[model samples]
Each structure stands twice: as C-alpha cells, then as structure tokens.
Target: MFSRKTRLAVAIAAACSFNQALAAEQEQLELDAQTVVGSADESAVDSYRSTPSSAATKLDLTPRQTPQSISTLTRAQLDDFHLDSVNDALKMATGIQVQEVETDRTYYTARGFDITNFQYDGIGIPFVYGNVEGDIDTAVFERVEVIRGANGLMSGTGNPSATINFVRKRPTATPQARIDLTGGSWDKRRIDADVSGALTAAGNIRGRAVYAHENKNSYLDRYSREKNVFHGVLEFDLSDSTLFSIGHTLQKSDSNSPLWGALPLNFSDGSKTDYSRSTSTSADWAYWDVQENRTFAELAHDLGNGWQAKAVVTHVKKEGDGSLFYVYGTPDRDSGLGLFSYPSEYQDENRQLIGDLQLNGAFALGGRQHDAVLGASWSRSELEDISWYDTTTGTALPPLEDWSGNIGKPLNDAGSNGSDFTDRMQSFYGAARWSLTDRLSLITGARVVDVESSGGNYGSDKTTKYSGEVVPYAGVVFDLTEQYSVYASYTEVFDPQTETDASGSRLAPVEGVNYEAGIKGELFDDRVNLALAVFRTEQDNVAEMAGMVGGRSYYRAVEGLTSEGYELEISGELLPGLQAMAGYTFVDITDANDDHAVTYSPKHMFKAATTYRVPGLEQLKVGASLNWQDEVYNGIAEQDAYAVVNLMASYDIDPNWTVSANLNNLTDEKYLTSLYWTQAYYAAPRNASMSVSWKY
Candidate 1:
C-alpha cells in the first residue's frame, strides 16, 4: 500500500495536470445533462446506449462519464443472445474469465483476481459462491452491470478485480404481458410469463410479476436438472414527491445424478486417458438441490433543491442440500482398478440482511456546480453447514469392471461434522464529482469500514475483526472534444485473510492498489460508446495455502503479486437497426520475482456480438457472436486456444407474436473448460433451441 503522503502527492499532481488542460479548452466547452434515452423495456432489447447508470458511481453518470470500465448486459442483449444463466452471460462479456472448478462450482476473475463483490439494485450483498449452484436467474433482472476495478467505496471488503450489480425489473405504468415456450435438444423444455401494469385506475399503484420454469437433461448419462423462479414487485406513490416499492423473489433448483468432478485425465501408468465427452463419474443416487427466497423494500423522498433521500432494506434466505460421489485414485491402464469412491452428503443454510440509506443532490461549491452522494450501509450474513462423510476403512467398494455410466451407490453412514460462519460489516461512504470546468471533472470518494468474521468447527470458534480501515478513491476526466474524453483513476481494496503466520499469529489483510488510465469516445449523439484502457494492479501480503500445522491447514501471507492489462471495448448502435458490441483484452500476471505466472487466466481474450434487423423486413432479425481465448494453464496441464461461435434468428409472425431459434457452438469445437491435477472438464458440444412467444 502507498503511504498517505505519497497518495496525496499523486492526487495533487494529477489534479494540477488536468486543471491545466481544462483551462486551455475552457472557452469552447459545453456541459449538458447525461442522455436519458428510452427505457430497457421488455420489447426493446437491441439498443446499446448505457446511460444514467447508478452502479459505477452511484450518480447519474453515463458509461462514458464513469472513470472505471463498466459493461451492461441489457435485457435485449441477454434475450437476443440466449444467455440463460449468470455464467452464460459473463462468458460473453469482455475481459472476464470464467473457470469451472467442477460440474457445479464456477468462479469469475478479471484483471488477474477473483470477483468477490456483488450488489442487487444498488444494495450490497454477500459474494455469490459457485459451489451453491445458485445462478441468480435473470428472469427478475433488467440488466447485469459490471465495474472492472476496485470498488471499495461501496463494497467494504473485496478484491480489486470487479463488482457485479444487478438491476431489478421494475413496475411499469403501461399494461404489458408476455408468454413464451421453448424446446430444445436433450429434451429441454422451458416456459416463461411476465406481466406488468398499474394495479389502480388512479395510476398510483403499479405491479409486475414474472414466472419461469425449465427442465433439461444433459449429455452426461442419467443427469437432469429442473428449476423454477417467481418474482413480484409493487410500487406505491405515497405522495407526489415520495415513492415506496416492495418486492419478493423465490427460486428453486434440483438436479439428479449430478457429477461432482470431471473424469480423470491420466492413468496410473502415466498414459493419458481418453474418455468420451458424455462420460459421467457420478452415482445414480447423487443429487443437488437449492432453494432461495428474498424480500426487499425501498423508500425514496425528494428533499427539495434537487436533492433526494433513499432507503433500502432486504432479507435473503437460502438453503442448499446435496449428495456427491467423487471418483479418485489413478487407475490401471488395462484394469481401471485403482479408483476408489468417496461419497459425501452436505446441507447448509445462509441468511443475510442488508440496509442502506443515502442522500444525493447537486450543489454549488468553489464557484462550480457539483454532484455528491453520502451513504451508510450495514449487512450481516450467517451460514451453517452440516456434512457427513463415509469413513469405512478396510475394504473399498468393488472396482469398476468397465468405465460405464452405471454405478451402484455406496452406503457408509460413518462420520459427521458441522460448522458455522458469520460475517458482519458496517460502513460509511461518500463521493463527489466537482465540475472544475465545463470540460473537466474530478471525482473522489472514501469509505470507513468495519468488518468482522467469526466461525469454526463444531466445538471451537475463532473471531477476526478489522476496524478503522479507510479506502480512498479518486479520478479525473477531461473532455478533449465534444466526442472524446480522457481520464485517470486510482482505487484501493483490502481483503481479510484466514491465514496465520509461522508463529500462529494471523497476518495483516491483503492490500491492493489499482492504477488506470483510459480514453473514451461518444459518437452519433452519444449512442455509441467506445473505450481503451491500460491498468496495473499491485497486491501485498497475498496469502497462499501452506502445509498443515498442528493438524490444521494454514496459509502464508508473505507473497506478492502484480498484474498489468489493457482492454478495448465498443458498444452501441452501429447503424439504424444494427447493434454491435466488441472487446479485446490482454493481461499478464507474475509473482514478486516476476517469474512464476498465475494460473487459469488466459493471456488474451476477444469477444464480439452483433444483431441486425432486415432494413425492409423489419420483423426479421439475426444475431451472432464469436468468443476466442488464448491458451490457459493449470498446475497440472495446459489447454490450447479455442473459439466458439453462436448464431440466432428471430421473426415476428405478427404484431403480437414472434418465433426465435438459437444455435450454440456452431462448429462443435471440442475443448476443456477447466483442468485439475488429475481431471479435466470439457465444454459442451453443439446445441440448439427454439422458442415461440406472444405479447400484448
């Protein structure tokens, strides 16, 4: 971490340089309110103008005005591209890296670190753990926004990679309804319904509801999944200047014979094992299930003088239960005999509560008009897990005669254990954007955070608390012309570690400092946005898992890591009826000595997607996307570079009816999505889906 004196010096120098440039163009600049275009309503999904975003700075700033790299996957984009799940959507995003640790466990990384922060409707929430198989269904969301950099101003504790913000679908003043049915390969079936309108004739109360169900079988033998989602929201206009909204969301997921891990890659003889793409190592009895519920309320009041006060509260409860059978041990090339089955069952419950209150307004300061936001937030998350493992020693289950899909379930019922974890955080944060001139602006913010975590095995507990940690943020943006802007930003983040030093004393938290500079352009009346940025992130006290001590595993926090990367992105309407989005990323990460490289993250990635409507046949539209990534390395193996392309087409049969079809993995490229020391997970092959919809 940089010293306070150094940070201050850097900020002052950047401010002076930006101020000088602003003065040169002070006489020819004009500032106007950021564009507020049409809403991302249900029917309009192809436009790419990202405006009035509250995720990046909690202010009315367009993507071009925000200092960080931000991306929004709008409803149109999701629907047109058939991004059904959070994982699927993120894979199409630029500069994002998704790793599948297991069939159900996934992780997202950017700028060389894991993304551990998330939000819903501008409210902070616990990080989404991939092991839970909770995808945060998109049926209830209007868009998914991502900020790729440190965001400690609002997120109290996290990494510097990225923060995800989910914007919920809101009640509309106009009546609307839609229904859709879909069928696809593997006997996949899906149904969806959405309705929104004013509930009262006076137009003081509005409501929206969404319902969806899906069931599908996978290529893996005997594996199937079913999921359901329900979302409802209501808005009340308490008074002319006051509004209140309440909502509820419920989701359930169930899977049969789910695979815990991929098949082994090598045999005991050191020869590579070639398994079919449809191979499964899971027993017929293995299953995974999850249930989640959330209730939330928000109040907003105008405080006069262009100021507003808002308050939000949310409660979330989630339960996960699953049984897993893992296949281990290197097998003999000929007999396939050395493998052993380790069966386990687990159940867990997670409950969380979050509250936030903020005030925002525009004020005159230092002879300039400025915008500022002040907020305070509190959150608590509690988790409890119970697990049972097979401990029958001596004899193992009969060895497999052949690698077939049929395997008998084991019954051991030998050992059991439980654990509980709780996390609490309270923070006060504030930020202001000062318009030094019509063409120049300076943004700065800070957060004072206090966080604590307590948990342990059933019989013992340990508590760690971090207090009075202050994270600062600053940025400068200067408009070089009406269509071009350049900016620089610095942000800090801190992550609490569970590791202890050699003396058994817990080490200090991991510290990260991120530096970024970029250029932005807005063309065609701000309908098209483009950006190019270069960034470097420094980390100190990075923790690495070490050997066991005193019968318990620990970590060493003496390691240092650094990452440097550059990204170029373009998104918006390319023509009258054509929308396009494209991005390319390059990243390099190394250890303290700059020799050993980080694993699992690709060095180069490129993504492009476009949709075009027939100029005359306006009812017909076609879209396609291409995702390419450079080679990636795991500790045990390396995966060659690969590219996957997808195509989609939609035709409106009439004013109220439409049909769509999507084809994924058009080339049926075979590749590995993840690699472990002994196993490898392969990507799915070609698949197709078609849907029919009606709206009124």
Candidate 2:
C-alpha cells in the first residue's frame, strides 16, 4: 500500500511539472492572445439563502429545488459565528450533532446514526472515527453543504445519518488579498492569509493560496495544541472551451498531553466522583500528532450544443502518531485511588484515491426540455495501524494518592503485530430530471455499486464483498407558486458489516431506507429561504456494541431499528442589512425491542444566529447566536441539557480594514459536551477573541 501511494505521488508531481512548463511557454509565445480574461464562478451573498448548491443531486440547484432537507454555512456565516473548524460549522447546521469522543477526535451524526460519508466538491470520500481528517481546518472552503437523510443516489455506501460536502474556494480573475490576526483567551494566537489573482500578465492563468497557523491552550490542565495549514490552486485555460486546474493542501496538528478518555463518572464504591471540570486524565508525556496531504486535478470541457463533460481525480494521505494514557477503572473515594493506567503508543496511515467522470447536458425529450447526467466513479482506501502496549504483570501500578494529574508514565515494551485494511469500490450512476410541465418536475436516479474489503492480520486474512448492489433514488417537486414549492423524495443506502454472529460467522450487510416530505419557500426575491421537513428512516441488520467475551469486546447484529424526525429552518436576509439563520430539530429512535435506541442522539436540538448593521452607523455591526441541546446518555452516564449564547461586534474602519470581537458562552454556562461509555467530557467556559482583518 505504501509503495502504491509513493508511485502515485511521483506521477502526479511529474504531471504538475509538465503542466507548469507548458503554461509558461504558452504564456511567453502567446502573450497577446492570452489577454482573454476569465472570472471566478463564486458570488458574494449577503444572506444564507443566496448561495446555490450542487451537493444533493450533483446538479446546480437551490435548496428548495433539491427535494430534500439541505443546509449551507456560507463564508459570511462562518465569519459571523467565528467557526474555525469543520466540526464547528456542522454544529451550527440544522439537525446536525457533534461530539468530542476524545481529545482531538470529534464525531458527527444526524438523524440517529453516525455520519461516515463525506464528499469534497460533490465527490465521495472515506471517513473514519477517531481520525483527524474529520477535524481539519475550514479556512480553505468557501462553504459547507449538508443533505439530511439517506443520500445513496450520490454516495455509494454509508450510514443513514447525513452527507457533508465541502466546496473549495476557486481562483478569482480579479486580484484579491486578505490578512487577519487574532488574540484570545487561553493564550490563543492565530494568523491567516488569503490571496487570489491572475498568475500571468495576460490573465490567461489564475491562482489562489491560503495559509493559517494557530496555537492555543485548552481549558483542561496540561493540554495545548498547535496547527498550521497551507493550500494552493492554479487554473489554466487550455482553450476557449476547455479549462484545467490542479490543487494541493498540507496540514499538520500536534496536541501535547492529550487525554485518551474523559474523567470517570463514578468511584470504585459506586459513588459519584464529582470531580471538577478542570480535572485532567492525561500526563505531560502524552501527545497526539497528525499530518495530512491532498492533491487533486480537474479537466472540464464544453462540448458545445448545450453539453459538457468533466473529470476529476483526488488523492489524500493522512498519517498519525500518538502516545497516550487512559484513566479508567473506578476510583475509590476513601483511599483517593482505584484508577489504573493503560498506556500505549501507535502509528497509523490512511490513503485514498478517487476519480469520477460526468457528462451532463440539456436535451429535448418528447417535446419538452430535460436535464440528464451520466457518471462513473472509482475509489479506494487503505489503512494500516502499528502499536506497542505496556505488558507489565498485574497491569496495576500504585494507586494515586490524591487523584490528580500527576500520574507516572509507564514503559511500552510489549510488541504488537500490525493490521492492514483496504476497501475498493466502483459504481455507475445516472440521473435525469423531466420537465413534465412548467410547474411540476420528476427526478430519478440509480447507482450500481460493486464494493469489496480485504485484509485483517498477516495470518488471519479476512475478506468481505458485496457485488451488484443497486441503490435507487426518486423525487417529485410541484411549484405551488413562484415562491413556494412542495416536494417528496425517497433514497436508500447499504453498509457492509464487519460484525459477526454468536457462531463467529460474518453477519449480512445493513440496509437503510429513507422517506421524506417537505415544503420550501423563497421570499425577498429569493434572498431568504425556509424549509419544513419530516423524515423517517428504517434500518435492518443494525450493528451494536456488545459486551466483552474472551477478554475482548465485540459487536453483534440487531434488526428493526427506526428513526423519525422533523426539521425547521429559516435563513437569509429578512431585510437589507439584516441577516438571520434559525433551525430546530426533533428526533425519536426505537430499537428492535421498541425501546429508546440511540443513547448519544439527542431528541431536541436548536441553533440560531443573527447579524444586524447599525442603521446610521453602516460601518458597525452586531451579532448573536444560541445553541441548545437536550440531555443525552451513554449507558448509565447522562449529560444534562445545556444552552449557550454568543455575542459578536465588528467595526469596519474602512472598505479594506475591519476589527471584530467575539465572546462565547456569554452567560458562562457550565455543561457536558459528551458522555462516553466510560467517561464524561465538559464544554469550554467563557472565552473571547479579538481580531483585525484587512482586505484589498
């Protein structure tokens, strides 16, 4: 797997070199003709609803036309809310939930299940839990798109949660530059730079680049993090009707004294620990580090006659290393001890290759205009993990005297064999939209997917395959008026299971079906949008974590799991100079036994934000936000209901200069963000940041 990745990297490098040389020569020889200038497709929107998306069906469509519950976080919104990470953006999206299972390991879910499917620019990619790929910085993205419920029509395989799509910022024909510097509580410091413009004097070639760096101390004692990222892209006009582009990104993150798990909820005698939120479970010697790289290339051609074809290729490589200690065993309140340490060290790498081609155009069918798309895609992901564990006899050191963060680090001498896993998938998909009438439309799509996974241990060697799985999707939309539309959609997806039955035989794959109906409306000349949707999902062959057997934990298959939910969202500008976004979600989950099934999925969640410009003082703006969630549980531990409020203020010194201040947890609310099976994680306390931004 490593060799394959190395070869691919070298090939891409050579291609990039050749492209650059060719571009330079073309620029020198055809300097006068290269004066034909091009502009970026992106548009600045004053309201959330002004942005159009292509994530739902891989077609340029508004949120109301997608026939599903969709939400977007625009760059303007991100700036208003001070969202720095992908996790932060998702948390603000409608009906979405995020949890920090461990330090630097955040997980996302929608409806009632974990989200495992992710896409970049409408292309599918692999996502795994406890991987830093899920928590990368969001500075390079122009916006984030989310589709609620099953999305099998576009994503070949995934859980029934939701699909998240990140749209990258494109190069601009007009020269643009921006810089920001920030200082905040907890000794936080950050700097960001973005620049985009024509690369050649004749304006035939364009380029964009983004760079960001941040270092901060955490609320938890003895924990600190540092991160740096760089992204660059170049676009060249191969001809009047063709375009070529290539991009690369590099990001690195390091967390010192990172905890493996949160503090315990109960003591050894079954008594509550009631420890302070500032308590830490990690030692100074523990750390976690991650480095990731991505390279991509694209070619698009306008075939003329209202037809176009596009091909894209992307490669991602992520490497992680960690040495950590977990504090778990029940504690003894009387003796001030009962906890034990499980120390280990590990190194892992994940590599992925994805390619897709699509031909889309408008055609006259049966005396009416229709849109159709034919596409094929191939993707593969490979992962390898190597670890060393502490093998001391008794596995118990001296108990802590006062149960502080002064635990000693143990030696990791015991060796463990490495494990490797690989997944490959190929699919053919097609979709078409028929304009039956000016007010009604019918859209249908399907994908035939062939997927296989192999590799476990060097000796054990296990494999799983699912061939010829057909996932179908359909939707209907009726325009009640120029501003209102009603729609319904049905979609399905499947996941191959790795869990085994009691007899140790692999279980069948899980299947999911989603039914949705919604009413959408656009107001203020399509500058404001609103949607009310109700959804129901059914799953068969669901996998659940089972109790330990043979001194190791395992998973089992369960049947008859259902989740029903409703979402309400309103976004965009109610009036000029005033922007707002509000959302509320309610969900209910039932298991095979007809009981409350999901422990981590909250039944109620809500988020809202608004920004207003002072009527007379056009240069001053004020904003506020609210985030609330109902109580959640993991096994016996429960996280109580919580609500937080944030406030922001900004002053535009001039057209090119601005200063802003952000205050989080305005009321200083104390809450728990996650309740894992073994421990509880607390939310951060009140914090504030001030920044100055200059744009030209």
State which candidate has the highest TM-score. Answer: 2
Give the per-residue lDDT digits (tens) of candidate 1, residues 104-179: 6666778867677778887878752312364557888888888888888767764678888888888766566667
lDDT of 1 at 641: 92
Q: Per the 3 Å backbone cut-off, how many clashing residue pairs does candidate 1 have? A: 1
Q: Score candidate 2 by lDDT.
A: 0.78
Cα lDDT of model 2 by residue, 532-631, tens digit: 9999999988766554332122457778899998999999988788899899999999987989987777899999988998899989999999999999
Clashing pairs for model 2 are: 268-331
Q: Which 10-residue span in candidate 2 carries the lowest summed lDDT?
A: 545-554
TM-score of each: 0.89, 0.91
Task: State each model's C-alpha RMSD to the native.
Answer: 12.2, 6.0
After superposition, candidate 2 runs with Cα above 4 Å error = 1-42, 128-134, 269-272, 393-410, 457-461, 497-508, 545-555
Report the Cα lDDT for residue 215, model 1.
85
